[model samples]
Target chain A: MNLTLKVWRQSGPDDEGRLVRYEIEDVSPDMSFLEMLDVLNERLILAGDDPVAFDHDCREGICGMCSMMIDGVAHGPQKNTTTCQLHMRHYKDGDTIVIEPWRARPFPVVKDLVVDRSAFDRIIQAGGFISVPAGSAPDAHAMPVPKVDADDAFDAATCIGCGACVAACPNGSASLFTAAKITHLGLLPQGQPERGSRARAMVEQMDEEGFGGCTNTGECTAVCPKGIPLDTIARMNADYLRASRKSG
Target chain B: MTATIDRGKATEPVTQIPSRPRRSRRRVSSNSLKAVMAVSGAVLVLFLVLHMAGNLKIFAGAESFNGYAAWLREVGYPLLPHRGLLTLLEAGLVVAIAAHMYSAIVLARRAANARPVKYAAKVKSRADGYATRTMRWGGVIVFFFVIYHLLDMTFGVANPEGHEATPFDRMVAGFDPSRWYITVFYVISVVMVGLHLRHGLWSALQTLGLARRYPVLKASAAGLSALLTLGFLVVPLAITFGVVR
Candidate 1:
């Protein structure tokens, strides 16, 4: 199949970027989106030209390292699929795919389609993991966590720290990402110790990061790669309120 | 001992200075903005319901309608000043309106600021829904309508016979079929308000942490918004069709 690519290109963080189009011939339908990009990069490199820059690691979709805004949608046209996992078969021979990086103020682009996601890291650092002493691992069955709680926690825990929630959100709010982490830890018995502090600290960090507040538009969850539930935000609000009262 | 002897203010960061608790530091977090919206929106909904009920009195004829309008001003006789109770209520409503609009504008500005760059391609998603998209524009229309409504009804400048006319006469003159533009404007603005309230109420409840466990509250919010819309609209239609006249 033959196709065209309209990829965003910028030399550095300060440089103005534009969509540079390239026509490719004899494209295979079975190739992954990233693989097609790799082919384009090889051609550019052979022609002594600058290649398009993007982020990807563990292309099978587990690491959440890949990021792209495909055709105005996060992770392309597929639902619950990562950019790296998206195959080119979904596209037509004459399709002109548009790829962009996450455009939030907090997530500045490091290169073409590669943003500095350290803001997400800082949010997690604020209060994502439980503080457990490093000696012995606890027995899994000893806790006796209810199945419903376990299921919900697992669902929340599936968030891969992809910035798709930020990219997809109309308000560009990180509430979903923040809430997913909050719910994941807040649901477990082991996480009860610092639950109050966790919610307050993380939400404060999120606000400090300059991400817009959620308006419950639900676009974040709808385009979420992990299919993180929107109700995690409700969970976050409940936790934050409880924490504020306790502080008072 | 020598190394430890340099304990002085110069080594400290500016933020490390000890100070009193900062109460004002809690100025409208996202959740707090949402709380403000919910509280203010609740007041506005109350006003709409009461206003609709008052307008419905036109069906009872001039004496009933005019008496109801006049009675609002003379609510507390010797215990309060003239128009005292109504003035107090109006003052509260003004405060609620101010808070609601301010939060909405700030939230919208922040949302815009968060994304400096926009998508190059058109994003088509019906899943985003009609209310989410039209909220800002709908609000603007409603705000303008409120101004026009006050001029026509309360202050009497826009009405045909002026504020001196009986409440019944003003209602009839304002929504007369001959003045189709005013009627059309009223219809458009009220429908926009209905749409705004439908989304706004659900969002307010969700923001206030009430809709998570019970999904039925969302339905109720929609129903109430629709009811208020029809309540307000029926008066204008009735006037235009000569049902109330």
Candidate 2:
């Protein structure tokens, strides 16, 4: 299938960018969206043009590295699917696809279709993990966690640290991501020690990262590749309030 | 020794001042109105449920419905003083309505400003039903309806001659089976209100920090929406069926 691609082109973080149109012909309907982009890049290389730079690794969609806002939606038309997993069959022969980087203040455009998602890393680093001592392992039965609690924790743990929630959010808030991390760790007995501090620190880091607040529009869940529910956000909010009150 | 013993020791009482209650009021933030909307909407859902249950008295007979309305008015008016409990309740409702409106406007404005580019082609969903989509519009319509209801029922302003109605009478007359237009409008508007209340109630709780647990919060939100929608719908249906008259 032939498709018209209007992709954002930027030299660097400091460079002003614009939508540059390129027509790719004889594309296979079975080709992945990224593969089609690769075809475009190969043609660009042959034509003595700069190949469009995008972030991708483990193109199987587990890494969350392949990021693009295809025609405004995070990861294209399909719900809860990553960009790499999206196929050209979703579009028609003459469809014009608008490809751009994730638009969030925290996630700045490093280049075309690639935004810096390090802010998410910093937030996770602040207090997203349990400080388990390095050893062989703990006895699995020692904690004796209820089945319900274990299941809930598992649900919360599915967050892929993708910035899609931030991209999809109107406020550009990382509450969903932050909440997922907080809830996952805070639910277990091992996480009890730093639960309060973790919530406070993580939320502060998120705020410092310049992400916006959660408006409960539920768009994040709608677009989440991992299908991380928005309920984690409520938990995070509760934890944050408790932590702040205790410190205050 | 006697002179030394004569030396007197005097102690003074240290006066500890009571701290004044902190006078600082938390200014409404950008999300504050949303918070207010969420909280008040939840409370209003409770009120609506109770109200519908009370209106179910209409099923017993006209005497029962009219009696209930009369009882409410009497209890709210003459039985109480000029500044009474009912007055305070009415005042609270007004405040809740004002807060709900203010927050809604603020949120709508923010949402509008945030979307820099609107989609050329948007997919509409059944889950994202018409009532859900037109929440803001529904709110405006409901606001107007409330005003009209208050005028026609409470203050008795411009009561049409044929519809010489009390609050209960007005409700019954509005949903008269033959008056299809009125019934249709009532049903549609109430459904809109239900849809608004369904999400609005649970969202209010979430915003107010009550729904902190996962799944439970989400469930409550969904449950509240469903319950409120059902609760609000029953009254109009009952009236239309002549079960409430």
Candidate 3:
């Protein structure tokens, strides 16, 4: 398929970025979106031009490293599919695809379509884990995690830590991602020991990072590849409220 | 292989642990401020519901409508002084509105700061419905309308019948058939409020963590906002059409 690609290009972190158009032909319909970008970069390198730089790994979508806004929608027009998984067949001949990096203060553009997502790591560092001593694995039957709690935890755990939620949110809020991490642990019996502090610490860190507050728009979940429900945000709010009341 | 794995684990460097996580020392967290907005918005919604019901009394004629208005000022008359209860309620509403406005300004600024650079080709998701997009501007319109409404009905300043007129006279003259522009502005403002309430009610439920458990609150939010808006609109329409005059 012959297509027109308008991709964002930036020299560095402090440079002004602009969408540079590229015309490419002979693209296979079976190729993934990232594969098509690879072809473009290969051609650019052969032509002695600077190749477009983007973040991607695992090409299979679970790595959460692939981040780009395809024609404005995160991950592309396909629902529940990351950019790496989006195939070229979704487009037709003579189509013009406008690609850009995630736009959010917490996720600044490093260069081209690559944005720094270390803000997510900082939020996780604040408290996205259960406190456990390293030793032989505990007996499965000894813990006795209820089926429902385990199921809920697994559901929340499905978040891949992609910045799509922030990219998609009008407020550029990281609430959905923060809430997902909070819910993943807040539901388990093992997570109860420091649940209050965990909620307080992570939420404070999320705020300190200059991320916007959630307005319950559900845009983040609508574009979420894992389909994390908006209820996780409510759970986060519940936990935060409980923690605040106790602290008071 | 197991021994090698254990050896690797033994050689792993132990990272330094940070100090214990501190409790929230900030006077107000983000969600807490949102809760304040939600609670205050909920109070305003309740007041609107009651106000709509009172307006509906116009169908019973001027005597009944004016009497109800008089009773508002007469309640706890000897104990609390004339219009004392009404004054207290007005003061409470003012405080609620002030809190709501304060939170909105701060949160809007934070939202702006969160995305300093705008998306070049951003598209609105399906979930970002019309009501959601119009919230900020709709809120401003509602704020202005409330001031105009106070001058026209409560203060009797903008009423055609002047300040000496009875409550019913002021309301009737406010929406006289000849003054169709006022009625049009009233309709537009009321609809804006309805739109604001539609999104605000559901957003409030989410912030308060109620919608997650009762997902049905989303539908109730829409239904209640529509009902209250219709109730408020009926009185003005009735007066303008000479049905209640």
Candidate 4:
């Protein structure tokens, strides 16, 4: 397949970025989207031109490291598939693909297609953890979590911290991502003690990060590569409300 | 494989992640503001339902409609001053509207600030329904329409028959066939209300954490908004078409 690629390029965090077009010929349909980018980068390197820089660690899609907006859709058009997992067969010959970095105030562009997602790490640091003793492992099955709670926690745990929710949200809200972390920890027995403080602290941190409030638009869930449910947001709201009341 | 992966230093104690000190806070959190919006919106919705029901009294003839309007003022007459309950209700509505508008302005501004740079390609989504997209602008239109509606009906300033006229006369004169423009504006504004209410009702449910548990809330939101739109439309449309005097 022959294709036209319009990729965003920026020299630094403060540099003005714009889409730069490149045409490639004889592309394979079997190549993953990133692999095709690798091909493009190889050619640019051979010609002594600067190579495009994008963040990707585990191309298997679980690492949540690969972040790019393909045609204004987070990750790509393929539902529940990250940019690294999206294959070229989804496209055809003579197709034009426009790729750009995540556009959000909280997620600033570090370079070409590489936005700093440290805001997410900061949110996690705010509360996304349990208070476990450091000395030794606890006895097996000591804190037997309910099956239903375990299942729900597992579902919320699938969030890969990709920041796609913020990128795709019309409000650029991080509610879905923040709520996923809150839900994953809040549902278990061990998480019960710090539950109230966790909800309050994490939500406060999220707001301080300059992410917008959730309006229940569901665009974030629609574009989420991990398929994080919107229900987590409701749960987060409920928890926050309860926490606020108790704290007051 | 010349890639260098820095997985934090192995000797660094992973016991506890350093947590930031809590900042001094006075501003209301976004979640709390959302609850305020939801509660206030819900109050306004209930008021609309009662108002629509009251308007339906017109079909019973002018006497019944006027009598119903008079009775509203006389509510709790012996126990309280004339129009006391009505005034209290109006005061509550003003509070609701104020809270709702304040939250909306704050949240909308935050949403704008969240994304400094716009995407080159238009963001398309199957889930971005018409109601969801029109919320901000539709809200503005609804706000203006409410002011106009109060002038025409409650205060009688915009009505053909001014303050001294009965409620029935004001309503009839307001939507008379010759004054088709008023009816047109009324229809357009009511439709906008319906669209706004559709998304808002569901959003309120979601914010209050009820919609997730009760999936029927989504359909109910649509159905209730449509019903309210129809309920409000029938009277003006009936008057304009000469179906009601």
lDDT of 4 by residue, A2-58 (tens): 999999999887799889999999899999999999999999999999999999999
DockQ-based ranking: 4, 3, 1, 2
Candidate 1 structure quality by residue, lDDT tens digits, A163-182: 99999888889999999999
- Report, for every candidate in turn, its global Cα lDDT versus the true structure: 0.85, 0.73, 0.88, 0.91
Best by lDDT: 4
Candidate 4 lDDT at A61 equals 93
Stretches of candidate 4 off by over 4 Å are B1-26, B213-215
**Which residue pairs show backbone clashes in model 2?**
B38-B204, B198-B225
> How do all the candidates rank in terms of TM-score, highest first?
4, 3, 1, 2
Worst 10 residues of 3 chain A by lDDT: A128-137
Off by over 4 Å in 2: A9-19, A77-80, A89-96, A125-155, A170-173, A200-217, A244-248, B1-36, B59-62, B73-83, B105-132, B161-165, B172-184, B201-245
* Residue-wise C-alpha lDDT for candidate 3, range B1-245, written one tens digit per residue: 35444676778894433322444565467888888899999999889988988899889888999999999998997999999999999999999999999998888888999999988885757585878888888899999999999899888888899888988889999999999899999999999999899899988978887775545777788899899889989889988998977
- DockQ, Cα level, model 4: 0.53
| Candidate 2 CAPRI level | incorrect
Query: Candidate 1 on B1-245: residue-level lDDT in tens?
Result: 35556768987763321222334454457767877888899899889989999988888888999999889989887688889999999999999989989998998888898898888877645145887788877888888889999999888999998979887888899889898788888988998999898888878777776666535766777798899989888989988988877
What CAPRI-style quality would you assign to candidate 3?
acceptable
Per-candidate clash tally: 0, 2, 0, 0
What fraction of the native interface does candidate 3 get right in terms of contacts? 0.72
Q: Write the per-residue lDDT of candidate 2 for residues B59-148, one digit (tens) a residue.
A: 677777788766655675666864476567677777878877887786666455434333332322312244446678889998887776
Q: Fraction of the real A/B interface contacts present in each candidate?
A: 0.55, 0.10, 0.72, 0.73
Worst 10 residues of 4 chain A by lDDT: A126-135
